[model samples]
Target chain A: MIAKEKFRVCPDTGFKVFDTTEKLIKINAVVAVVFLAVGGLFGLLVALTRWPAVHLLPADLFYLVLTAHGADVLLFWIVFFEVAVLYFAGSVLLNVRLAAPRWAWAAFILMLVGAVMANVAVLQGESSVMFTSYVPMRVAPHFYLGLILFAVGALVAMFVFFGTLVIAKEEKTYEGSVPLVTFGAIVAAIIAVYTIASGAIILIPTLLWSLDLVADIDSVMYKLVWWGMGHSSQQINMATQVSIWYCIAAMVLGAKPLSEKVSRGAFLLYIVFLQLASAHHLLVEPGISSEWKVFNTSYALYLAVLGSMIHGMSIPGAVECAQRRRGFNEGMFGWLRKAPWGNPAFSGMALSVVLFGILGGITGVVLGAEQLNIIMHNTLYVPGHFHGTVVAGTTLAFMAITYLVVPLIFRREIIWPKVAQWQPYLFGLGVTGISLFMMGAGTLGVSRRHWDMAFTDAPLNFDVPPAAFLMMGLNGISAVIASIGGIMFILVIVGTILFGKKRGEDACRTNPVILPGGGATVMAAGSEGTLKLPGTIALVSVFFAAFVLYYFVNWKYLSEVWPLS
Target chain B: MTEHLNSGDGKSGDSNGGPENGEQRIHAMQSLLDNPFLLLFIGVAVPTVLYTVWGVMEVVQVPIGQ
Candidate 1:
């Protein structure tokens, strides 16, 4: 039970910050960054290995690095930070003490042990089954065990989040509906529970099969169940990052949603429809039915896509409305131009929204199409699309929020403010290049999983186009740049937390909340709360144009292929 | 003076629980979306049926590979 003495009123935000909640957030965030560095190192090796010019790692080492890269960054680093976000959202936003603090620690321990175990297994080289760790690829038992334990731990953290909500309500933290950011986090937590459970359902049996406790696991069954966990984990990231986008918009720009009902409705659509897009992974499988694929990919999946489009409109629309109200109303683009570009939080968020929507959202619908998938499935395009979503979108947004989290949660000023300002552009542009080049190579029919694109060692090599080789080289160079950006972020955050100057008590105790670095909090400059955001309308129209153009281009590409009866 | 864009609404619907509006009620009944227990139930249950269950059933009916 939390006592009054255990709670401190945050001088900046005025949220009743629980001592345990703050500590948990600090630990989770620090550990998450550690894994990010580890994952980044492995990822650089992977990119170099993929480059025809460099080909850094041997084939075996390449697979090992690839396995570690996927697991560490995608599964461990992201989830750990997400757990931190859950604590921040569920407890701090609601102004409630975290429920079951001891249980939260237990969850962290389980996940850490699992992550270490899984990493050790991969390094041993016998368990290099890659991220999917598909059926028939028997691995070291600890590999599956590590992942299983990790999932269970994450599942426990979600329960703690849920419990914190219940406590918020009991203590009467706030009146009316919960805030929208908290609402989005709840959506993520719920999806996480399902994802972790799905992981356990498939992995436990696979663990048994690895030990020869079961004779054989069906390949088709494994793929189907695995993606329920695999891809849904991504869906969890999508919801959470989108929530962070809203949080950042409010913090830096003081933006509000255009309409709560419409925004919440979009989140609701995610709950009902987002995970079905997981079936996109199985669209190429012959065992799956056309009826099932059609429904999952296009029919129902479009509803989920609509959910994303709604967010794309509303987040910027909110920002645009906020900017105009601030009297930045010179022209359609003035609000955007006069907006806080110097703020890494705002820039990172803007990049995440634009790149993810334009690159990830468009290619996602394309790959999900059962017909279109015939060209792109299992190609470099898949990773390219996710790099846009996870790296450019989610990871960048998370990095953006760290600018605030350091000052707000950690009570520290950023070490190098200028580097922090430029970090997002460097990382965002680097990853954009990475994603684009990979997509280009994929379009040219380059393989995704192969270590040597040149096939210098293959018995019989089908020559890939020279452009594909050029794209692969460009992708490798981009990875180097992104790696530098990623390392810069890690160094800045680490320096800030460990050595940067501590923020003094907010003598001002200003209304609303104080922004990090004494930046402007989003304010109400308009009386009616009504602004005709022609700029947002224009920006979104541009997005729709790009989407329409890309969609037909893919169809045209599909048509140029050999005819099938 | 809430950081969230809730200008004149007097509700602190921002990320940080903003300044409390004058002496609001102890507890408020939220919409179905705001109810975590109910949302978690439906979020988990529906996805299981649509993606996991429906998918596994389709895979189950497939004849074993030679």
Candidate 2:
């Protein structure tokens, strides 16, 4: 097979690039962007409708747009990119030919068909059950079928990832452990396997019920099993994005993990504890044991938080250490201040780390508390929290990596480099505003799924505070800004891929500012490999202080909600 | 300069840069698999044990009928 196969070593990065893997990665990434465009458009409509002033869509259209938005952005776009990431991490990183290239194509087609089918079903106005599609709502059969096909296809692609790993091992691609990026990807794939299996367990039955083949479905049972797939999919994102963080840090700064064993231990903790977050959704629901809820939400889930905390510390610690080694050591913050912020890759990733750790991580800990969930569980705050994690964290990280992928993988110079430099900041600011304002409105008790925040059309009108209305209006404005930023991203990625000038091999053959020797290896700076990380320690202290303050604030709010004293 | 190294450690660099011989490739992979941390069982086994014990204790400690 080795003698028979023909592949090229990327001159810029020195990774073995298989023709099929290249085709697969390119196609998946392009399609993922297409979904992002569609989803972002739907999201703008959703924002306008939620604004009391705008109220853009009627109730029916609002739910439909919301459904499409969730499906496209959360499920379709992210997973398609993830499939590409799996292939990149597996075949390219391991320097092995992809196993079962033909099957990989089949998986891609199935996913594309499923995604389009689900979207079409939503547009038809019969499947506007939102992404959860909770039981007894009774969506069209094709809606469930579309999701099932998509899950199965994704599962097949995951298997292809596994097969590629085995092929790499059998072919002796690398030594010691797999690279940490590949290691994190493996964690994602493992979690994805369980998630998709959970989907099959619940969804297959629900599909039967939808078709009237089965009589009835239990709502609680459905939610329990559904979240195993639903929320865990986000867990997959968490792990994958963390992996990309490591990759970006290494690529841009030639950084290494603070400690391989500790980092690996954190990843292992994710494998054990991350999916327990699904229980957060079920905390306030009845009939589930308090013991189960308490354990899942508090003790075990905190371990998962610990995993995230480790990555948060180590990723920046690695960067600071590497930067200092390169003589950027004027002050505690000089290394960070002197970082390559002009590079969209570095800026996007850096913002993603800060926003995710501060906004997502803190809010997540608050929500995961069994008692504290009562006030905010069904409010707009839930989506606000996720926006912090998914959009600000994962999507931004993915967008950051796309900057590198365009040049390295597609062999094109980035078009409009100046615009690319500012794109992440604009996007980050808008998304941050959206998250904050929505959470503020939710604190005043804005319903998550209600189309009109004003209750203008409700049978019995209720007064939502003036501040809530103001926050909704601000959310509308923020959405417009974010939409512009998103458009800029799509334009840059699409324009560059299609029309950007071909990068000469000589120009890419060496990356002197980052990697040495034309990207011959993932250069990890700092020969000593010690954790003299005062900067990271200070940062972590600040994070903990914020976390503690927010935790107590939420508890105080919870107490005020009950006036039982 | 004789052989290019991939993303692993120094000593285990492929002798000829490419996968020239089956035995050499197998040897490299075996060394990776033999490492305690890399093996899947060693990686996840302890966490699984800890979670199980923690779960049981929480279940026992929960006040019944609350």
Candidate 3:
């Protein structure tokens, strides 16, 4: 018989928490926050350096900071937290033991070591090739090796997740189809396997080339393989974040998906067409052919966009449906208005859905279009778009879910409940400014990754528009504000986990976070068992308007660049 | 209405799913995701063929140092 001590039940929700599983979630999340703090600091420095007036770091250091910022936040921070999410979704949600707890520990150690090794390589001042590290621009051999190790570790973690799912099925953990959250995680893990495999296929050879064991690694091949890894990493984020969006909605507001069929179909769409977005990074490449480009571009990009757009609607529709059932029906947006805006769990997910869809989703579609790609391909517009997606959309979504994670998994009261309420808005506002201003600077033709915006010593002495300078100044200020938001999130969570009272400890205060307050009591007529989401429809229609206007705007901008005369 | 959301949580006792035993006896959407192996195969195979294989082939056709 298994050790009874290994399995205990959460009193609040009755989730079967394995002792090892809980530790893995806590440890991985803790480490992810550490990297977020480190990476966010570098990001702030990079932003200051970009601002013409501030010019925080010199050219050499600017590149170093940029490279570190990408690797740490993009790779280390997000992936570590994702690993935690994977375990929670699989073992915890399925109510099964994590398959091979020994292997899980080994995976954690390998990941931790690999992350440190890569950081060491970057900080050593020799490997400042940035995250892409495109071929013939060799980075330290250790950099490639570190990443390879990390990939191997992640692959191992994926195995444990899959194995646990098998255990759930065989043991009959709960019943019927595994939770939708677990299903979304399954999609993420599958994407991760494909992504990490792509990384290995390219990185191993690159590592050999770095060590002078190979003559050449083709640049075109590198681009193909690397983006299969790189862009797909974000795809993993999208799938995982959407899953958590559903989870937070269910846990916080007791919301059901408006249509489970539509929501699952949307996730299924990701499995089908999402990775094709690798083409977005390669649209401008010369080694690639026209037929190849067009086929990949049109065939893949928009279908994937359709998948994201589906999610954009479903999340809000579910939220509004839940609110209406609670008797909040008044106007088109009454359900939205009465939503628990003060609850970080609800607000964070809502903001992520809106910002990601409007800013990230729409801008991304335009960028992937061959004609529009030409104009914004090398501009700060690219970074602007990603900030909207990655930081504003994915990171904010992750931050939102962390509110739930702390209470649910960590079993602590939020140290400062009032501050927790406003964290998402502050962070959301800052990143919104970052994405918008950067895109504005990009529109005025600012270079994406260049250290010096002024070009003080260039031979041509070309002058960038004064407006672009102002945009970068605004972007710098936004970065500082976003960093403060990041700090606040870290402080709130860290303080809570380290020092806050244990949940349900005080008899008088029943831990509002555990059961989640702000519930609506009665089901309004015509609302019960109906998917009438006028509020969500109005919200999505607004998104549609934004997308159409932006699409035409970019096309018009393209016309200005290339005269028909 | 809210407890209908438990089909997602898969907790016991619900009209949408789960019997009194806490084992969800049946779920309509479960068909696709229930089989981890099949989904894994589909997810991995579809992309490998569609994106990776095709892209690598195109890259291989490029002339070097021409």
Q: Whole-model Cα lDDT per candidate?
A: 0.85, 0.83, 0.82
lDDT digits (tens) for residues A338-409 of candidate 2: 999999998999999999988788999899999998889888998889989999999999999999888888
Single out the weakest 10-residue window by summed lDDT for candidate 1 chain A: A519-528
lDDT of 1 by residue, A25-61 (tens): 9999998999999999999999998888888888899
Model 1 C-alpha RMSD to native: 4.4
TM-score of each model, in listed order:
0.93, 0.90, 0.93
What does candidate 3's lDDT look like per residue over A1-565, in tens digits? 6565387776655677899999999999999989999999999999999988999898888888898899998888889999999999988888889988889889988988999889899899778988899988988999999999998998899999999988877887665556778878999998898899999999999999999999998888898889999989888999999988878777776776665656667888888778878887888888777676676667776877787887787778877877776888988988888888989988888899889887898898898888789998888999999999999988998899899788778888888888888889988998999999999998888888889877789887758899999999999999988988888999999999999878763421465653333111101001123457777787788889989998999889889997897
Query: Which ranking of candidates, highest lDDT first?
Result: 1, 2, 3
User: Considering every candidate listed, which one attains the maximal DockQ?
Assistant: 1
Model 2 per-residue lDDT tens digits across residues B1-66? 122223233422335445543333444433543342354443234333343234345445545555
Candidate 1: interface RMSD equals 6.1
Candidate 2 CAPRI classification by DockQ: incorrect
Clashes of each: 1, 0, 1
Per-residue error (Å), model 3, residue A335: 1.8
